[model samples]
Target: MINYSCINQLKTLKDIIRYTTTIFNESDIFFGHGSDNAYDEAVYLILHALNLPDDNLDMFLDANITKNEIRKILYLINKRVTLRIPISYLTEESLLQGYKFYIDKNVIVPRSPISELIQNCLYPWVKNPESITSILDLCTGSGCLAILSALAFQESMLTATDISVEALKIAKKNINYYNLQNRITTINSNLFDDIPIHQYDIIICNPPYVNTQSLNKLPKEYLHEPMIALDGGNDGMDIIKKILKNVKNFLKKEGILVLEIGNEYNNFVKNFQNINPTWVTTINTEKSIMLLNQEQIP
Candidate 1:
């Protein structure tokens, strides 16, 4: 039997991993107490505790670890399981499109599937790829989308706009981290209030679309994140509607608008009649990202 009291006495990576495995086996609180894989979480917690990167653990998996390290890892695990704080929040890091980005309460954890679409340059509905000289990322928390845009389209100029200065600070760190200062510009704007009109070829947004009803129903782990980053108003489309109404003025002819509406697809579709027909809505297995051409705008 693993002694929970002794976990705080561990010192090395090996010892911490062993203790985590033992504790996980004895308790039902593995990986948010769901059927999800706990081993990955255990590994993440252990690596984070050691202040070691994931790659550093491959060589030491079978090696002996110390008591002090086990204790630290256990303490973090206890906080995660009991307090329900997201592991990403605890470690201040998240992986997106093969790169690790620093993250915290300043922004939502990077989990948008749009990264894959951008990398592949596969938004088929787009009319003119070459016309995509400038791209705008609205509601650009952490500026991941804008940073990735600059990296993917080296010739394209990018602008990242967010209402929160704290989120902008984090986004700027990512821009500097990727050495993309020359191609990407960070702006503090609620929406398009400060952006030049008819300038961008593509406008990407992952706005807060969680309606008040849904916001109240979010999991405890989600509650730990900034509410401003998640709450989308009463129907969750308040921000999106505002963007749609004003986006056309900012997009060049043939430009495209991509909006990520996670679970609010139904609400979006319900409001589709209110939206101009020129904008097309695409629904995938996981998300609904709407696309609209500038011509579609009234």
Candidate 2:
């Protein structure tokens, strides 16, 4: 437990950040959502607590903080370290490709690398983003990617599906948040079961790809998220294989499928050797996402 008596000592933003970092280091905290370390996580929580912008952090480093604000900040910091909750869930908001959306335990945090492909308008993969008339966001947890896809492919109408009714409710809220109710529609489906027999120009998905072994050993932060959205069976390809087997049926002759498999690239390649996909790289690394044309599905 954090000593509330020390809250008065954190006068400046820097002081709070330093103190939070020390507390974070002393605790067993995991950092997978956006941040990667204690110092960065401390800064994130502090900035979020102060209701400040994340971009211009340096300007406010010396800003004086009131004791009341300090107490609030320290409480959250302790909650973070002790409870191992993700910062995004604590704030109930998350950013994907600069676009902010409402988030909670109902859906996984929006940190998919596919945001890069959406930002670039699917680029060399699609050649003409204007030609994409229909899109499907399978397993659309929070509708972050679905909304972003709608923004990028302006003319396309989207069908965002999720098996979880709770997740679909959150997705609907996000769609309405972006005022995209006219462009995006939500459906409760187990993959393509509830989807009508309509082929789409593009089918995008960020499904659960964590293998059983990894799921069992996941960090405490992940336990707070929905297990159904993170478990991918024995090899993390259970749902992926199902998609690979039926995606062709839902894609047009010239349509494309953008799928994110996370760290299961090797398993994906080894299993689907016949289907050659263009491994897309984000700003960080490659093999996280793959693009496949209808013809490539055999």
Which candidate gets the maximum TM-score versus the true structure? Answer: 2
| TM-scores of the candidates in the order shown | 0.86, 0.94
The weakest ten consecutive residues by lDDT in model 1 span: 276-285
Where is model 1 more than 4 Å wrong at Cα? 1-4, 8-15, 18-36, 56-58, 126-131, 274-284
Candidate 1 RMSD computed on C-alpha atoms after optimal superposition onto the true structure: 3.6
Per-candidate local distance difference test: 0.75, 0.90
**Cα deviation of 5 in candidate 2 (Å)?**
1.9
For every model shown, the clashing-pair count is 9, 0
Which RMSD values do the candidates have, in order?
3.6, 1.6
How many collisions between residues are there in candidate 1? 9
lDDT per residue for candidate 2 within 184-289, as digits (tens), equals: 9899999988899899999999999999998999999999999999999988999998898889999998888999998887788788888788888888768889
lDDT of 1 by residue, 142-260 (tens): 88888777776667889899999999999989889998888888889989888766568888999999999989877788887888889999888889889888887778776778778
